[model samples]
Target: MTTRQDGERRRGRRPGGTDTKAALLAAAREVFIEQGYDGATVRAIARRAGVDAAMVNHWFGGKEALFAQAVLQLPFNPQELIANLLEGDPDSVGERIVRTFLTTWDAQDGGVFAALIRSVASHDQVANALRDFFIKNVFSQLASVVSVDGRAELRANLVASQMIGLGMVRYVAEFEPLARTDIDTLVKAIGPTLQRYLNGPID
Candidate 1:
């Protein structure tokens, strides 16, 4: 029933309007899970949301910021995570990674990551979205930092296993030993194993 003129008038009247932002967020989640971070384009997300591609920039700044808000719901931007991890010496990357991750989660006060884990536990779609986010954002970034001969995918998976396990135990279940332990102790205990996964020779 709507004509082209009506559509043009609506588009021009509310560029990146409130409703458009919500639609973009929902569409980006589906597209990100379907195509992943590296494959999902801003244009595709905008098209899915039925908005102009420039609306993405106007509403969320860019794909990375949009993704951070749409998926993680954390207080910080995920795109900066890799740059933060790679700031110091390469030899201590594992230590830095563990420390940074724990610090970030703890600071959230069971807000972002906890909700994500709960959603992932309850729904397969949410789980797939979370998996894609981790694989594309966290695992791939860390794997890229290591130049070892091992399969980066394998290495990334191993790292994900350790970190994700630590999160569930330390944050969700609140295991006494790990939950009570100081951050330094955790870094010392878990960092070496992650370091080996990153740079050590695998058999």
Candidate 2:
């Protein structure tokens, strides 16, 4: 009975105890930011978290997942995107979606997102992970709500390109005009294009 109880306890929480996953993620975020993606490593993150390297894999699947969770910290979970997309009127989905995304980016601490963009540029795995997160979590969820023809994959990629460019100029590069502009102003300018991608005819 004691042995069984011990097993249950181990399964109940990480070996490092409660909040281990959170600690690891936080450590990973800091390391990724300081080192950039290529410079950051699972062993380094684990060391910062004060846990074995194996713990990272145990908790997050691998370095890529850790990077996604740490750097992205997306506004909503992938599932939530689907739920929101389903809630609003289908016709205005594009506007709502664009506004939603802009709102999220606006709310974050600039440094966190800045690190993510830097990492994406330098590391292929990080770039792929970023792509997967958008497709599986954000775009796929949105696609489930508004049935568009042609593989949902294509539509998702189109939307991603628009958002990625917006991120680059507005957040990463801090380009003039876009960087200084208000969220509402930017949203108005870009929302229509995003809407078209989501719902408008593709020719």
Candidate 3:
């Protein structure tokens, strides 16, 4: 058994604990940011964190899970979030989506959004990660539920555009009343537009 001092000195395979997990998360975040989701390896992250790569599997299951937690920092699991949004009135999913998004990102004070945008800007892999994160895992699933007449792809694109634009203007550009507006106020203003995107008829 590796004692505390021995474990500290060895630094090869860290025993499971809050500190080891935290170190892995911090290291994963940095590695994902620097190398992006595709390029960032579990071994590299574990090496940086001074832990065994197997610990990543123990704590996070795998690289994708680690990326989701450390880099995406999602407020909720992708599937759970989708399911929750789908539970309410079908017509009102758009509003719920907008509300949930604003509330979650707002709670983080835009740090996650800003970091993702920066990563997407600096790294192509990050852009792909953003696409997979938002488009495949989130928006497309939502669109598949409510979209009309095989328009899931288009609806997904529309929702992504609206949300990404809103995030950019509010978090990145820091433009005027929008950046300062209360969540409910923005939701009321933007909800209908997204509703139309999701529920609108396409010819």
Which one wins on lDDT?
3
Q: Per-residue lDDT for 1-203 in model 2, tens only?
A: 22545544543555665477887888898898888877888977876776668888888899888877777764446466557655867776666666776677778766766887777777787777777767667776777544467656776677778877888787778889877787778767877776677767666
Per-model TM-score on C-alpha atoms:
0.64, 0.80, 0.75
Which residue pairs in candidate 3 have backbone atoms (N, alpha carbon, C) closer than 3 angstroms, thus clashing?
none
Clashes of 1: 0
| Prediction 3 TM-score vs. true | 0.75
lDDT of 1 by residue, 88-158 (tens): 78889889888988888888665445555665666565567667877778776776677567577787788
RMSD of each: 8.2, 6.8, 4.7
TM-score of 1: 0.64
lDDT of 1 at 171: 80
- lDDT-wise, the better of 1 and 3 is 3
What ranges in model 3 sit over 4 Å off? 1-13, 16-22, 30-65
Off by over 4 Å in 1: 1-73
Ranking by TM-score: 2, 3, 1
Query: Any idea what lDDT model 3 has?
Result: 0.77
> What lDDT, from 0 to 1, does candidate 2 have?
0.73
Candidate 3: tens digits of C-alpha lDDT, residues 23-51: 89988987876776567899888877877
